[model samples]
Target: MEKTDVEILFEQIDNITETVQQYSNETYLDSLAVTLEVIFYQHPPEGMDEKLQEQLQNFIPQLDVSKYKTTEIRKALQLAMLKGMKGATQQQHLMTPETVALFVGYLAGKVTAGKKNLRMFDPASGTGNLVMAVLDQLETAGSVFASEVDPTLINLAVLNANLQKKEIEYFHQDSLRPFLLDPVDLVISDLPVGYYPDDIRANDFELKADEGHSYSHHLFIEQSMKYTTPGGYLIFVIPEFLFDSDQSDKLHAYLQENAHIVGVLQLPETAFKSEKNRKSILILQKKGPNTTAFNQPLLVQVPSFKETKAMDDILAQMNAWFAENMNS
Candidate 1:
């Protein structure tokens, strides 16, 4: 097949990024920011100047800024920047895989697509891929909101959304607090796991005080639910160990009593292999005053889906679970 404009632009941008990466300097981030600016925007943003343009010349030899539109440039820049994050040792941001991102987003869209109105939020929306996926399917799904603490990643997310002319109600602060004034219909995230700083949590999270001090993931789950509307859906791509820990017992109990946790699908170990964590997708439907007596969630052990039969079994397990709970 002949290469399309997107394919050709991405390849050219890739070559430029590879050259830029070889320059081992403390000013790497600044260089990258300027590189993106000169390529994407005709005017340097506010304080930046033509000197920033000099930085680009060394990396991209045959600069044809006129060849691509601003939107196309932004797309290539976003792709290059994210690729750099995955490869860099220092300041690396581990993004969720595209398949997983699309899966969760598609599932949410499938449920809420035809609804008259709906809102979706992601607590830790790295690169905005998850929200973008949701928008891809549920094109009519109302507004999108997300929070990211890291300055760089948040900026990338904003740019990615804007490139496609999608508006996001973005908050640059931590998503742990009561960020949204109004509760949303759906919450979707790949929650970040690590030790949350104690002094930070010394405020309102007295409920999970101890458990949160150990792992911030617990706090994210509890806080994420707080932002959701009653009977709203909460979807997370999180570690399997999130439920296994003794500290998480309270969370498990609270979810069971308060939400109809319809599915707990153990993702194949191959999903996203990091040295420390195996992941799972938890699908939750918070109960309202009118919700019926809670239903038991389907819990299934998935296999390594190397071939046809294993993949079939995994799908079968999830389909059976969805049949019972997607309505509740």
Candidate 2:
């Protein structure tokens, strides 16, 4: 069978990374600049919000599009970007894996049925892949909002959004800070993983009251939970250590007191095959002040990619679990 558009796009994107890497004199920065130029022309800034268009207009340089077709340009844009965001510059900068991306869509699709025009947020949206995943899974349209701690990575996020012709206004700052932002329906992110230094401002959150303690993934979880609407769902890709780690005892208590741990999915080992870190996706639905945990959360394992029956089986279990527990 002929290659699908997605397959072709992936191949072309790989070509962009290889080609850019091979350029003896070209910096990845220069290659990145070229990629951004291509993205803007391929997905014109017209019809975008005036402020967004104005912000985008300031940066989109005219490029030599005569060399490659529009499809190739978009792929090249993706390729260069994938290469640019290499590793954990911070937890916010970790590259989301393709398998996890697929699972994110699956997880979202399971619960979002019959809902239309939702609003979503990813606090530490590394290149906004989770944001992309949620939008892709939704049957109807929705708005995406995300914040990235890294300025450079946020540029990549903007470029990717332009390529997809999606509107996303990214806040470039620390997500841990208690900024007065609107509570969104769906809150999601692959939050920063390891310990945070005292100067990072994560300790500023009221939950991190212990001046002697160093904040880490636990802080991200707490802050994101607060950011989500009381009835909204907060999804995170967190370390397996979070399940019973001494470090997160306070976090666990807070979670027990305030939120409903909706779904715990053991991600496949390949979810972060590069770094080989054991991680899981934690789906929590925030609760109102007087609310008590009414439903027992579901804990399921992600099936292997080769397991033909895995995804369907996993989702089926979740569907039954949600039917019993979602609003109970």
Candidate 3:
């Protein structure tokens, strides 16, 4: 049988990344970045050894990146990135699961339905996977933005976005810091869970703890809200214990004052490595004139992905709820 586009592209990416890694002695991810550059530019960058350049030249013609759909391209790249991430030791380096990203995309599409030329931002765009997934689901020709603190991750994200022909303005700085950006119509992020190390900078945030390091996830929500236009929406994949932590009261107060909790959909336990890592999809609308809380917040317990029938039933219920409430 003929290979699917995603399979073909993943094989090409994997082969190129492996070849680059062998030649340059770079990590799998960094080598994949070089591979992406070569694929995108159709040539190895200047200063690479002649043998490696020749090898890359031989590989380029075999690639059929342009013919594939956006989702296929994303899937291919995501598979390659996931392979690289296997050897990574840092918790922050973890990629969002494709299934979760797709679900987020679906919810985003539903909320922003009928909107045109909307602006969106993702402050924790690791390798651009989640944001690109969201972009694929959107039916708008709007501005997109992302930020990341890690240089290697940001470089990969840039190359990933470029290869996919996504026009995203990226901030290669700490996402918690102030950005030279206008408030956006929507914000989405798979929030980085942990305590933020910078207490002094944490002082600038309303969600900052009164003492010691602040929970970075809390600060992320506040920062996302800050850059979301009044009446705009923010969607996040949040830790299940977000509202049960020692600092939950502060976060709760902040949200109550500034945004309305539109929904909280608990992701299936099977999706996570452990109960400690379980997360939920949280939707919030920034408080503004003419905006009111939903009559009944959307609260769902998502079924496991492996259970197709259960998943479909839950999605139908979600669709029905959205149709009833969001259309008004």
Q: Best by TM-score, which number?
A: 3
Q: Write the per-residue lDDT of candidate 2 for residues 1-328, one digit (tens) a residue.
A: 9975555555544444344445424555444544454445644334534554443344334333445543444444554556655633434545667567667776666555556787778888866666775666576547778888776677777777776666777888777776557877777777677666665475466456465555567788777777777767778888777767656667877888778877788887765654447788888878876445654677888877667687778777777877776543
Q: Can you write out model 3's per-residue Cα lDDT over 1-328, one digit (the tens) per residue?
A: 9998899899999999999999999999999999999989988999998999999999989986899887888899999999999999887899988889999999999888888899999999989899999898898839999999999899999999998899999999999999999999999999999999999999999888988899999999999999999989999999999999999999889999999998999999998878887889999999999898888999999999999999999999999999998884
What's the CA error at residue 257 for candidate 3, in Å? 1.0
Model 1: per-residue Cα lDDT over 117-206, one tens digit each? 688888888767777766766766787898888777787677666555677888988777667458888989887877677656534653
Greater TM-score among 1 and 2 belongs to 1
Evaluated at residue 79, the lDDT of candidate 3 is 92
Best-to-worst TM-score order: 3, 1, 2
In model 1, state the lDDT of residue 13.
61
Scored by lDDT, model 3 comes in at 0.92
**Collision count of model 3:** 0
CA deviation > 4 Å runs, candidate 3: none
Steric clash pairs (candidate 3): none
The global Cα lDDT (0 to 1) of model 1 is: 0.67
